[model samples]
Target: MNTPEPAYTPINCDYYDRLEAWATMRTVCLLKFYDEEGKEHEVSAVIKDLYVLNKAEYLLADNGLVIRLDRLIAVNNIPVPQSC
Candidate 1:
């Protein structure tokens, strides 16, 4: 089996912090994040819901997509700013 190249490096805390803001404000944008196997994925949708389970935070999109925050690489093509 061929190993997959790392598609996304870990992002900063500011990015994760903004995720809740986006969800709360219902922002629509393309979200880029990595899956458990390190494969990257993107989706164009509005932030519809967010919840935490088992100590992991997840971002739920209006289009029925869910992504874990730690795997996120970028939002709307912008790199995550440094955590404050």
Candidate 2:
């Protein structure tokens, strides 16, 4: 007899939508995410673009950082510094 594997659900779109909104509006946000080894990390940057390919998603930041959407834990609004 063969055994069946468990069903897996994909991550929700709320996180992606919120992030996209922030990116489109050029809003700065502090992001929290867990690394592959379950280590938590945080960073502050302005969202520059959102990308979706197949079932994968990513966020591009102005600082040339690429972040996976599924790894995101939380997003906090931040104020952007003004130029003199």
- List candidate 1 stretches off by more than 4 Å: 1-13, 81-84
Q: What is the C-alpha lDDT of each candidate?
A: 0.73, 0.68
For candidate 2, give the lDDT of residue 48: 94
Over the stretch 1-84, how does candidate 2's per-residue lDDT look in tens digits? Answer: 645422222346655566778888898889776655569888899999987765566778899977666666777933222111
List RMSD in Å for every model shown. 4.7, 9.7
Tell me the tens digit of each residue's lDDT in model 1 across 8-83.
3333666666777887888887888777787988888998877776666677889888886667677889765533
Q: Which candidate should be chosen as best, given TM-score against the real structure?
A: 1
TM-score of every candidate:
0.70, 0.68
Model 2 misplaced regions, further than 4 Å: 1-10, 77-84
